[model samples]
Target: MTSNFQAKIEGLQYDALQIRRNVWRALHGAGSGHMGGSSSAADLLAALYFHYLRQRPDEPEWPGRDRFVLSKGHANAALGAALARAGFIDDSVLDQFYAYQSSFGMHPDIKMPGVEMSTGGLGHGLSVGLGMALGARMQNLDFRTCVMLGDGELQEGSNWEGAMAAAHLRLSNLTAILDYNKVQQSGRVGEMLALEPMADKWLSFGWAVREIDGHDMGAIVEALDALPFAPDKPSMIIAHTVKGKGVGFAEDSYLWHNNLVTDEVYERALNELGAPE
Candidate 1:
């Protein structure tokens, strides 16, 4: 990679680490929150906010800005961290996670500056993102729409319907990223409802599909840079990640999916994450 490209990757990596650290910070302050999903998504979220998505953090309501919907809204801690880091919201908001009447709750809220959609009801964001993409096309705008999905939520039939519709309409501006960490709240996704043949399923539905390591900054950047893999189809990126990625004890365990983050747990997690440059 060129020096410039290498610098970019390093910068994103630092941002991802900070995002992970702040995710723990927010969850610990909340007393209990979804850590597994939030940690799993940190790298991808960092890439999106810092490298891929196009938007004016100061002018969040800009009509031409690209749209992103977090379908797996339970990972709001990570999203909040990204938004704060990107200057779309105050950093203090991270401390308000799950606070009574706070916008920074367990899920994304449209009321938040950088949040495109208020989502938590799994299987809905893809459809909403489809509409956004369609609207952009109808309005003759160059903006794109991306939706981040959770593997556990794919069991809902609504996502498939949106997938089929976007493909049929040839919404090439739409992209759906799956944070396929394999584990869910109660147990493994494979044990719950397998989504094997995952890539083939999307390809069969007419989407241009690509799979990559979600935690790999280089791979994540390359995938986002190659959006709408096909000119005539929506794109789907299956980003394989690890649940509770940074912390050893929590990694890959469902117990950390939405567990208590005691002071000790928070310290350990930050230690594992290390300090951001």
Candidate 2:
């Protein structure tokens, strides 16, 4: 049953590699930008942008399109790559990342064509997504709202507030994806403040929960497909991921949290990620 999903996951990895490359490529263009969170989100972002999110690349403001919130706005590089890959923006736009007067920055901005919310505040996306879902319900629109959250951000108590409220509203239109990469800026989440029993906490809060290897494309897609796992609750997909998922030098560590780019490091990162056949 899961084999087919695995095949899709393999494809998603390829897509993710492309995204990881683009992330560095974009940062290289900017000459400076976020990479740790962005790299960690590459695979999932590829799956969402290329396979799941019902979006209109040619129509960024399509009224019927599903919405995605990059709550961990530091991962905007991956989001930007996905958006470019999905055709919402010119691929070259990434080349201008962080350029003066450029829309791309360390965080996401709603002014950008493909960005739904301007988020960088650790624990805000889920709450905003709840509002978007609730609005969809009130408007009688079938569009769903998905929020991509950071594990470090979960330390904020306000996320629990949104979790509580989403379930209270029974917002099946909503889905919160926790990018559980273990490490945050300073160190490992476990060492900082453990978020163990993660799935249980969501379930206890009235959210229908699913756990998946965040870097596995198939698991991600299936988890997304399994949305609204309960008719009476919001859904939470907890993605266990590596801090810097693709690059060997960067994975699972806090040192790369906000790194400076150099020509040698850039080449090494690209080589580590490897070129696709």
Candidate 3:
């Protein structure tokens, strides 16, 4: 890579690290939150806000801005961190996560400046994103729509319905990214409800598909850059990731999916994540 390109990657990596730190901070302040999925999604969220998605932080209502919906709304801590870091909202709002009357609750709230859809009920974001994509097409707008999905959320039959519809309509401007962290709220997704042949399933539904390491900043950027993998099909990126990625104790453990974050636990997580570069 050229020096400039390498610097860009490093910059995004720093953003991802800071996002993870802020996620822990927010959860700790709330006394409890969804750390596993939030940490797992930090890298992808960083890539989206800092690199891929197009938006004016100051003019959030810009008509040409691309739309991104966090289908796995449980990971809102990471989303909130990204939005705050990108200047869409006040950085202090991170401290208000899960606080009474705070818009930054456990799920994405549309009332929040950068949040496209109020989501938390799994299996709904994809459908909402499809509608956004269709609306863009109907209005002859160039804005693209992207939705981030959870591995466990795929089990909801509604997602597949949206997937099938997006492809049938040939909405190439639409993209769906799956954060396949494997572990969910109760147990490993494989043990609960397997989604094997994942790429093939999307391909079979007529969507273009790609798979990559969710934590690899370079890979994530490359995937986003290669949008609309097919001119006549919507694209899908299945990003394999580890639950609670930056912290050792919580990694791949379902118990940490939505557990208490005591002060000691927060300190350990921050230590493992290290100071932002």
Candidate 4:
């Protein structure tokens, strides 16, 4: 039997920690990656893949499986980790990050069995998620749709268009989770362009918004479980997270947003994150 929600939450938390480690390991192999955004999203990805998402990794093309759109393609490292943990692929793929012919690149590709949509361009997933939900509804299928968005990606005008469309269509079966880590490529989001009243923005855009500590397994799971948050509207989760979560040196900084990973840096990162216990 599948684990209950809370137990699944616990197990997924452990899984997420391992995912974090795997993300770094993958980057260690690649020698560099988008570690900041990737690690920031580990918990949310874990919750989605391991707990909430009705995905059978061994049978990834399962018709009734829920779909996930990783809007922030830069975070593909974390998503790949979660997919491997969920058995969608062999764990050895982590060592091939950024490899010449690897499917596991810096951005998600729909060609990957478990990856529903090819994403790297911000602001594209929400609209796609709306389409997925509407398609499920039309087919009378019970599948749900989810999309993960980056904080910096919100600045893209395309997201606003998607937001307006999703609400107007009332895609209650679709949910968007914002990995609100507050920092982006060159500097803190606030310092560059603040996304203040972020929750209210989603609410005004016609989503039932909820804010939570993104790293808290309980919070992540609970928010995901309370889907739609209303009978006739889509739901949005504003997950407050750290930029480079779980690693002391990388946490809350833009420098690590696109930095090289050296053996010494990797060692320090592992020390801060600790072993997956």
Candidate 5:
């Protein structure tokens, strides 16, 4: 907990706030969006793009760059915000969310400079990320692959298949961050499909697992620093987060998952999140 480290965390915290603010802006511009998942992932996205991943924003196609697949692609607003803040994309793109003929949409688009995978259908990102990890190993590249998944997305069953494969293959370069926001669209995740014993589930699949408060910048950074928690196993970080984090009314509510973002709602959310620099 050195002063320098604290300062670094502080900077990330600021970026996370800005990311959240931008999430609301993007959704407001689109008149609606998946605000719950997007805001829930902002802190981790900030830490990953700004501090953890070895990526070249100016040269997104660099072969040596790490790969990040947003498995919970509904949270693309946060990813877009992070990329913009990191200089991988122009800030104006945030206003184009869901616009007709716009590359930026509700989901991640591979054509987007920094987006490694075009994903929106749940339970697919892990498998794609596993392939990237395997490909990196086959090519003798030192690059790593990380995937961010939503709590509800795990119910798809494909994620477990990929999890099993990654563990069996011993892809240490692969990491999965589960944005366990607890609530999902329509209702609380447990109400729709309970993933109780979630940590145990990943452990049983033979992956190294760590649970952390996803919104805490310092904790998030520490967890990222301890990647590949085991030598021959892919790492799984269960990031406990809140749906619609940073906004009082929306927080923990499924209604805000992808609801309409009117002008009034936008201003209220921005007030809670503060002005973005």
Candidate 6:
């Protein structure tokens, strides 16, 4: 990559680091929240909101803005952090997570300024994103739709239904990104229910597929930049990630999936993550 491109990647890396920090911060405020999936998705979320998506934070309802659906809605903490950082929402809302009547709950809320769809239930986001893509096509709009999914969430058959429909319809403007963090809430996803031959499954469904290191900023950006990997098919990116990425004690552990967050634990996590520059 050229030096300018490398600098851009470095800037996104810094944003991703800040996003991870903010995820912990938001969880700490709530006293407890879904940390594992949220932390795992930070890098890709950063790339999408900061670099790829053509969004207008100041004018969030702009009709032409690309749409993003967080199918793994349990990662709303990371999404909230990214939205806050991107100026789509106020930073102070981070502290209101899960608070009484707070919109920043465990799931994405459509009422939120930048959220494309209200989602948290597994296997629903892809379908909703597919609808958005079809709407764009039908309306002759150039907007694109992207949906983020959890590896474990694939257990729901609805995703496959949506996958088939998108491919059958040749919705190239739609992209599905799977945060394949092997481990889920209870245990390793492979142990719970293996999704081996995952890429083949998407290919079998007639979508173009790519796999990348979920935590690598450059790889995340590159994969996103090369969107709609095929002209006549939807795109799928299987991003391999660790459940609790940045913090040493939390990394790869299912127990951290939705565990309590105390003051000391929060401080320790921040210390390990260090200050984002």
Candidate 5 per-residue lDDT, tens place, 1-277, comes to: 9999999999999999999999999999999999999999999999999999999999999999999999999999999999999999999999999999988999999999999999999999999999999999999999999999999999999998999999999999999999999998889889899999999999999999999999999999999999979999999999999999999999999899999999999999999887756
**Number of colliding residue pairs in model 2:** 1
lDDT-wise, the better of 5 and 6 is 5
Poorest 10 consecutive residues of model 3 by lDDT?
A: 1-10
TM-score of 1: 0.99
Can you give the lDDT of residue 19 in candidate 6? 87
| TM-score attained by model 6 | 0.99
Cand. 2 Cα-lDDT: 0.88
RMSD of each: 0.7, 1.6, 0.7, 2.2, 0.8, 0.7
lDDT of 1 by residue, 116-232 (tens): 999999999999999999999999999999999999999999999999999999999999999999998889999988998899999999999999999999999999999979999
User: For model 4, how does the per-residue alpha-carbon lDDT over 222-267 read when each residue is reduced to its tens digit?
Assistant: 8887897998898999999998899988999999997899998888
Q: Any idea what lDDT model 3 has?
A: 0.95
With a 3 Å backbone cut-off (N, CA, C), the pairs that clash in candidate 5 are none
Cα TM-score per model? 0.99, 0.96, 0.99, 0.96, 0.99, 0.99
The residue-by-residue lDDT of candidate 6 on 20-105, one tens digit each, is: 99899999999999999998999999899999999999999999999999999999999999999999999999989999999899
Off by over 4 Å in 4: 1-8
lDDT (tens digit, per residue) of candidate 3 on 1-277: 7898899899999999999999999999999999999999999999999999999999999999999999999999999999999999999999999899999999999999999999999999999999999999999999999999999999999999999999999999999999999998899999999999899999999999999999999999999999989998999999999999999999999999999999999999999999875
State the lDDT of candidate 2 residue by residue for 1-277, as single tens digits. 5787677777788889999999999887777667888988887898888778999988999989999999999998889888888888888888878878888777888988989999988899999999999999999999999999999999999999999999999998899888888888899898999988899999999999999999877778888878878887898989988887778998888998888878888899899998878
User: TM-score of model 2 relative to the true fold?
Assistant: 0.96
Q: Give the TM-score of candidate 4.
A: 0.96
Pitting candidate 1 against candidate 4, the one with the higher TM-score is 1
